[model samples]
Target: MKDVIVIGAGPSGSYAAYRLSKMGLDVLLLEEHKEVGKPVECTGLVSKRVLDFVKTRSIAGKVYGANIYFPNGKSIHVEKNDETIVLYRDSFDKDVAAMAIGAGADIRINARAISVKENNDSVTVKYRDSGQLKEDNAKVVIGADGINSVVRRDLYRIRQEKVVSTLQYDMAGKIEDERSVNVYLGSKYTHGFFGWAVPGGEIIRVGTGSYRASAYPYMKALSKRFGTNRVLGITGAGIPIKIAKSLFTKRSVLIGDAGGIVKPLSGGGIYTGIFSANLASERVANAIENEDYSQLRHYDKDIRGSIGVELKKDGFIQSIYSKIGDRSFDRIYGLISSEKIIDTINRSGDIDYPSKVIFKVLIRNPALLYSMWK
Candidate 1:
């Protein structure tokens, strides 16, 4: 039996396996895909703090100090720090996987998992190794799987609801200014979700999300708006929108999407997944070493204590956009600066509606303070 078996080799799984491997634990990392990060699904727009924590940093593409957009041809511009990075998602994943392997975890690519069985004190996972059936026992199981996690089903017995579906493309484009992240709101702009323009010098990451069920038709609709069909390279995927209360269990714990840690608003899962995986890896390892499952007791509290309030505020933000209509988004983002945006992102992964964060943003842009009430 392995000391830990981390399912899914995404950011979360890789982080967990990496951390535990550094601790000298018998860790096994699993990835069903032939590659670690392919068919790049995420925009990879992350805050500076995250890059600092992982010690895997990225350079800026083009920083926009403020947003430039208008509703009814009325434009508003807000200043920003231009610190956010536009990383190659595939490269980032491969780097993270390398971090784990360097730390001494055994990673298995092309290993697909079908189901998990927990018996007595240990868990056995049934999966297909290339093609044949295979099983592995673990003293502890960390579900680092993505949206469709078998680990989540085996442990939490919870279903993923309210996932955000999206499609994006990387194409040729060079913008003179780089500090602004272009955001568009209102149903007229993006149907079920909103469209984003994260500029990467000559490349652009353009995509939208889905709030309501049965919105598959919206992807094609959005592609036309972004002119992705005309682009040479276009790619997209479904990210499990995690709006759950909490995602930890008795003996088993879910990390990343398996734990439903994606943003309530953006469906950005990489940072949240890595953050949660770090928390879970440390807690779970301590629990195993000390023979104490009690530490897993407040796993939610620890994670929420870190980023919960941000998630709640994001939930509020999403509600406003989903129901309030389009004209509000440009102003909403303009009022919030890059610093405040990072603060919200940093804190939201842990909790819902952080009052302190709201207060800061309100102070910065007093006008929207009323909208917070609205």
Candidate 2:
């Protein structure tokens, strides 16, 4: 029996497995896909903190600022002293997996975990490999299997209040400025959400996410404006904006998207996933050393304490933005276009946690509070 079986070989699972193995625990990491990081769903845009955490280098390009467009063609530009990196997600995932393997964690590809059962002493994970069903016993189970997680389904009911449907296309073209990203905000493009154009080294990734299913038309229009139609690939996925009611039950725990740790505002999960994975690994090690599985509760408490408040604040912000019309968005753009506000954003804006600046900005300009409240 393994000390812990981590389902899903994404950054969260691999990193957790690596950490647990480094602590002299037997760890098994499983990935359903034939290879790790296939059919990339994320836009691959992440902060520098991710690269620093994994202790690896990123060959991807950097984005210095964002051009946020409103429905009336008015825009707000926010530049930052520190830039965000456009990650080559496939390479990033493989690097973390390699570290896990180097730390003595065994990884099995093409292994799809279907069911999980927790007993008094250990948890049994049932998975399918090579068309054959198999089971593995472990003292603890970590579910980093993503938004539609099988482990989470077996353990508890995940009530996702909203799931953003995302569609992205990799088009062959060169953006005018590779150092900045473009964000389209309007009801016409994405109802209750937004669209983005990220510059990859040679190609631009154009995508949109909305609560409504009809988003392709807007994406296609945006693509045409770029003047290139040579499509390389297209991918679709769901982003869960709601946090799960519970993250652990007895011997099993869920991290990453499976636990809905994604940022409610930007729909980014890389940094949060890595952060949660690190905490979960520590809890796993403690539970195993003391031979007491109940110690897993600390994992829940720690994660919630760290990022829970941020998620809740972002959720409220999302709700406010979702209800506003395009004209209201223009008004917001006008308010944020002030030199003082823009300067404040440039100095304090954090993509991973925009709420920090939002509160600060609101406090500085009390008049702007009417725009959000009214």
Candidate 3:
């Protein structure tokens, strides 16, 4: 039996495998797809903190500012000192997989994990590979599979609080502001969330998300406004919105989307997933070395103390965002767009922890806080 078996070769899973393998544990990494990364589902816009995880060659472009548009036809441009990196997700995934492989982890492509059964002392993962069924036993199992993770559903039998349907397209066109991403907010356009146009070098990525309705109509409208119909690629999927009740249980643990640990406001999971996976790896490694699987509970506690704090803050912001009407949004926009408030946002804005600037802005313009609630 191997020391660990990681289901899914995505960034989170691969990073966990990489860290565990580097710590002298025997790890097996499994990928469902024939290739490492394909059929991209993310917009690939991430904060600079992602650099702490892996070295990648998939950076497609960079932006230093954002233009947030309210429903009233006015917009607010917030510029930051640091640049956000746009990546070609396929290459990014492959880069993380390479690190895992180089760290002495055994990787298996075209291997789809169908079910995971955990016993008193070990975990058994049954999978399909090369048209045959197979099983592997390991001391521990990490579920980084994704939004519709089979391991999470089969093992925990739990679901996320909500799932947002998303639609995104990559279209080749000359963007007006290549240095800034455009964010559109309106109930008529995107019912539950927001829409965005992010420049990716020669192309632009346009996307949106909704609660129970289809996001395609909103995405089409946003794309049309940007004057882009020369579509290069299209991707659609459901993104889990909130964090799960728990992340680990005995010999099995969940990381990334499998644990529903996405940013409530932006739906970005790359940095958070990789970061959580790194933490899980440390705890799992310690548990294996001591043969005490109960130590896995610390993974959940550690994450809750660290990133979980940020997620909870963002969740409160999202709640305010979803409740505010368009008229109130425009009024609040007027307050936030002022030079003083804009300066505050520029000084403290952080995509990884957006609440930092938000609380500061609210403190400077207390009227804006009232508008958001009204």
Instruction: Give lDDT tens digits, candidate 1, residues 194-292.
Output: 667777766766666767643345545545654544565666666676545656665668888887787776677778888888888889889889977
lDDT of 3 at 366: 86
User: lDDT, candidate 1, residue 185?
Assistant: 55
Error in Å for residue 335 of model 1:
9.4
Candidate with more favorable, higher TM-score: 1 or 2 = 2
Per-prediction TM-score? 0.85, 0.96, 0.98
* Model 3 stretches astray by more than 4 angstroms: none
- Per-model CA lDDT versus the true structure: 0.70, 0.86, 0.89
Stretches > 4 Å off in candidate 1: 57-62, 66-71, 213-229, 327-374
Quick one: RMSD of model 1?
Answer: 4.3
Worst 10 residues of 3 by lDDT: 220-229
TM-score of 3: 0.98
TM-score of model 1 vs. true structure: 0.85
